[model samples]
Target: MAPKEEVWNPSVETVTPVITLSFYFYPTSTTGVVIQREGFAFSYSEEFEQSEWVAYSLSSLDFSNRNFNRPFFIEDPKVKSRSADWRNYKKSGYDKGHLCPAGDRKSSYKAFEETFYTSNISPQLHEFNDGVWNRLEQKVRYWAKKYDGLYVVTGGVLSDNLKSIGEENVAVPNYFYKILMTKDGKKMIGFLVPHEDSEKALYEFVMDVNTIEKMTGIDFFPKLPDAVENKMEKSNDYKEWSF
Candidate 1:
């Protein structure tokens, strides 16, 4: 967690546009600070010292395009309160989990590097982060490849009186959720996994998006036609989504 001794090189790529996602799903009015980095968008939570949710779109082409080395984690100076330091995870039995995963943004070095910012991280149990959580992230990439493109929204369930760590009192969520959908809204699925390790099939954690919305208190895809949104959110069609 020591500061880098060498000069850090920032990417020259232009910042990514904030135009792709529909306003219906962003919740900018009620959500905390909204920032659009190279590969993803996020609603950061000052109270929890991490993002409440991170949203990004993945395309099939990104899978094969490029790769880069991971840089040292850095505090997100853009965060008004200043992000938690990486040193907080030392001997903490938790991993500094990336909300907008680096793998999803490998299309550009800048995109990949932005993910290392501290504001995008939350404390996660080592077993859970490496196990089912990792598997689900891989699945999202697979779906991105199959669908050509997909929209993903992921985050931990933050709430009152959670166990905390570090001087920041970073909240440790007992459960985390991920919701994904094809760009056209023809197909969608949601998964809610407890913040613990398990060896079960991924679908075992699948639930309707409505269930997820209720559980998280954040409206997802509010811009879609109500009829389409209602139906998609209410249905958990596992058969339609290939593993």
Candidate 2:
């Protein structure tokens, strides 16, 4: 018989304190399989609550020796704004800025590069991205060391229309989010934090995978039953997550 196709399910778990999140593992054509699900919603402070962006180190995730590349085709025209020009911003000695650092998952250049996907990016000041956000990515790695792994989704909320420099047209985020999961198949946890530089503007509130899909109008883990989604939303205790 042909090899059976592998499947995955969201595994919800609670991290330190009262934080609860969801994540899942899926087969990948190149990497054989990868963790590809995340739970959490990103909304304006006035619209939804926020959370803090913690840092994780590459060493903690055991990816210190791996090579990785940024994701291709990551650009959000909507991320542009009147406050600063892209070209000027680049020349100003600030990188395009990735909320999910490449170093965290440096298994391969492809994996590392995917971190550049516009969907996973935000217009953050160099100091913030390189400093605070970078630290958060490292901290996540530390958590991974103990838990064995984590699947995270993070990004910023675009509240205004800003024009792209070269095109002179308003920019819109092709995807206003970034998701990462672990290859190991134990517990699954995800997070969604804001791109705003202020610590106060980060991860304001938390929600489950279902709530995230509802808020974003996107369908995640389509193979899962409706009851599964429902359960994730209602239960604060993540142990209920199952296939």
Candidate 3:
């Protein structure tokens, strides 16, 4: 059978202000756009309405490996399940850490649980996710609270070579990345951090939306125009907006 077509439903916009700018939040994740103060603009994925568990089909984007070409469901569960190959990972002393925290997306419980998918996870040391990465995710939330709301996309990077752990297959990402846009749709900021823990790696770096596109091979904001992509790469001013 052909796959189910993803649909987006537009909702009212909510705007709130921060120190430098104001933000906007649409009730649903459907069609929305954000413009940054630095003059970069981006389109967001269609909001997953009716349910928080939106299936982002990896096949939809241009990202590298075909092995990762499957639909990923985002949900929030009380406890993350152990991977089939947990023993192998445990022997290596790594935990199936979540790149996108369940709490950050807790607009709803179901949405929160779906975020626990192993596909969306990476082999991370307990210290890194619990330490620096956790702090960063909190900062993003703080920014969201200060401003109206921020637009965000986060996930692990998968390398070309796929590895098998225990009985399940897993892919190691070269890096993990996240993109945040201010609410008013006027500012966009991108951050890339290595999968390993390092104090120096925590600092935020400037990124073009395309940088993520090139890495994930997924076209994040498919509804947005081409000009937004062009604008994001040229503007470095958004770097100053980082904390």
Candidate 4:
């Protein structure tokens, strides 16, 4: 039998210690229903009708130039509360933006297809999705190739006051964030970008993980040692990231 998965509580430590397939870099949950897929894992937010955060491991070997047919977005079967429907984005003037980008999972057809699950998507403006966000995704790929591998955690800053769309009322976030760390946890960087298109350099959006933690109430990389986590999360310096 599979090890029992722990349901984390944001208020206090309320989980049993059990080793699971989840990566050590996975973030803590604010909401419930943590879903682990073949390619990634995420915490589903029933209130917002989307994932609170998505995380996965990336490496040069994970990238393939193979062309695969794009799959239609569908509700994830693993979500106990049921993920939002893909139609929630249709005619809503927002794109069903991917949290675990399909490009990153192209090495395998199943991995790529898993990214289309609605649980791994968020409502995003088309321009923003195709513009700066796409640029950042490409940058992440480049860094993964350069660094050998990285652990990436990303998602929108979901809140109650944000605009909602479609019959399900999927919340559209005002900002999005991505945090990356080397496999050895020696280098870390975070970016917080406004939910819009801009020609600004990516480095200009750099932020510290500590600030993001406070905003999202998600404890990132909780498995790391306290001293290392504190030092890495407090630094916003991007000089080591090579832009």
RMSD list, candidates in order: 8.9, 10.6, 12.4, 5.7
lDDT of each: 0.79, 0.39, 0.45, 0.86
Tens digit per residue, CA lDDT, model 4, 146-180: 97677889999987699999899999999999999
TM-score of each: 0.88, 0.49, 0.59, 0.91
1 or 2, which is superior by TM-score?
Answer: 1
Residue 225 lDDT, candidate 1, scale 0-100: 67
Best-to-worst order by TM-score is 4, 1, 3, 2
lDDT tens digits by residue: candidate 1, 9-32? 222211234223433345431455
Model number with the top TM-score: 4
Query: On TM-score, who's better, 1 or 3?
Result: 1
Ranking according to lDDT, highest score first: 4, 1, 3, 2
Q: Candidate 3 lDDT, tens digit per residue, 101-178?
A: 545433334334444544335666677677767777777766666655565666554435634343344444446677
List candidate 3 segments past 4 Å from native: 1-90, 162-164, 201-204, 239-242
Model 4 collision count: 0
After the best TM-score superposition of candidate 1, give how far the Cα of residue 135 lies from its true spot, in angstroms. Answer: 0.6
- Judged by lDDT, which candidate is best? 4
